[model samples]
Target: MTFQLRVLLVLAPILLPLRSSISQESAPTTTPLHRIVPQTPAELRELFRYTATRLPIVSAHRGGAGPGYPENCIATFEHTLAETFSMLEIDPRMTRDGHVVLHHDATLDRTTTGTGKLADKTLAELKQLRLKDSEGNVTDYQIPTLDEALRWAKGKTILVLDQKDVPLETRVGKISQHKAEAYAMMIVGSFKDVVACHRLNRDIMMEVMIPSHAKVQAFDALGVPWQNVIAFLGHVPPTDPSLYEAVHQKGASTMIGTSRNLDRVFHRRVRDAPDSLRRDYQMILGRGADVIETDLPREIGRLLYAPLSKSPLGHRLLRVE
Candidate 1:
């Protein structure tokens, strides 16, 4: 007890002062703020409202998982969170058990061990299967339900869910159930889907998926603002980078894909055909693509955030906003 008293006498003054300063630092300040982005949703929205020039943001295709983990699973979403990229593109489908699960195809043969259609399997049966990667390495990342993915991803990152062939209301309902309000960039496969989104989620910043050249004009005429669209001009060939201009003129964002099924990732596969080896990064970006969805999220983030070789358009504007 005498030794303890001696120690307390020696430390009390030092520890008490340290705690006093720590409390001061923890207290809030009354200064006004300047920055908006890398901030809350309201701040981000305000920043968007005032910005004059719109540079496309980085988006990870298929949760940014290359292999082992199943695409669009919780594992994939986790992988996207690891990178500097701010967004994730995932696919959502309903299981026979009436649960919303992440899977690209309607069939389980491509990514899962189960055979036949995804609707055929119960949630229990689906969980038993393994996930296959591009190289055919099957791992244990079982298909994660959309609710499961949302419960984890609500605040961390924006989810660009490729919701094809499913009821739009049903998918939106899953999001609403969480009450956490995760940003869902819904892929509008049809005009009906577009109409539904406009009517239902007017407050949410959406990215409607536009497929055709004609539909682009039609949607734009309907007063679908530039902020609400992401032109999914599929399989965009290098020779036709101009194909995106019409949509861009409408002031909407456009989505570019890069993979074996779409364009190549490398810009200078010179030995190959001009269109074959050259990824559409430069071309699509040249057209002012608002979002470039890439398979290599980390690598693409490096490229996107890299210092620009030239000054942007907003730099020269006489009355730049």
Candidate 2:
């Protein structure tokens, strides 16, 4: 048999079982407050694909920031996972000594007790500093290495690694080293990055930012299979109705970011009004978003899952929500 035929034969067993699991069933009334991390690459891919289309797959922006739990910390991730099967969006940065660490800002001054650039500190030095919660209050939590975070997420929650200061090769290497290809996904900003990372490890899933239909087409031309990609539609409400359709046609899911919209629309106009929040969510879902990424996953998840009569809007925004 030829090489391609052999590859297909190998993949059939993994792909065949997924069809039955991926369904349009409604989400359970009570979301289990526990983590269910994918143990294998096939299981991870199946879960990722299923969740993307299943609607209301909450991705905790910066590890579900709240009162005591700080963003991107292990404790924060665990806290969010305990509430729902969340996808934690984390930033991976490299220290001066080359250890990959979980942190959002380039400087540790904002979230941690350390001062100056994070690149200036070694992993040991970075670890000694305590993390601060969302309210800027000091906590006992310390900065965790990317490896530590990935290992912790195993079989618990999905992890989306925001490529910040780290190189694609380095990040992919770490994921491979930890055997986290299933549990972790890297956010690639360009088509070149997508191709490069895929070439490095075809099993490594990617979250791509394809802002327009033209951009989506351009990415399609790169020949990376859509099954391995999750297209990001940006922070603003999408103007093109065809964008989501195009992505869906390619067998990929489109992610709509509500982090900016929460500040721009909900906070400014609604001011915590339940009715307005539901309307804004409906507007985004109406535009064909497969997944909603928000800073407030808990609140968004609640709104998405709220009963039709209780919700300001009568119709359900997401099928599973």
Best of the candidates, TM-score: 2
RMSD of each: 16.4, 11.3
Q: Which tens-of-lDDT digit does each residue in 65-162 have in candidate 1?
A: 65554577666555444434347778887778787788888898888788899987888888898888645678776888777877766545667667
- Cα lDDT tens digits, model 2, 3-98, are 223322322332212221111222232543445456677765555463322434678899877677788988777666544446889999999999
lDDT of 2 at 95: 97
CA displacement after TM-score superposition, residue 288 of candidate 1 (Å): 1.4
**Alpha-carbon deviation at 32 in model 2, angstroms:** 6.7
lDDT (CA) per prediction: 0.56, 0.72
Model 2: colliding residue pairs: 37-155, 37-156
Steric clash count of candidate 1:
1
Clashing pairs in 1: 56-290
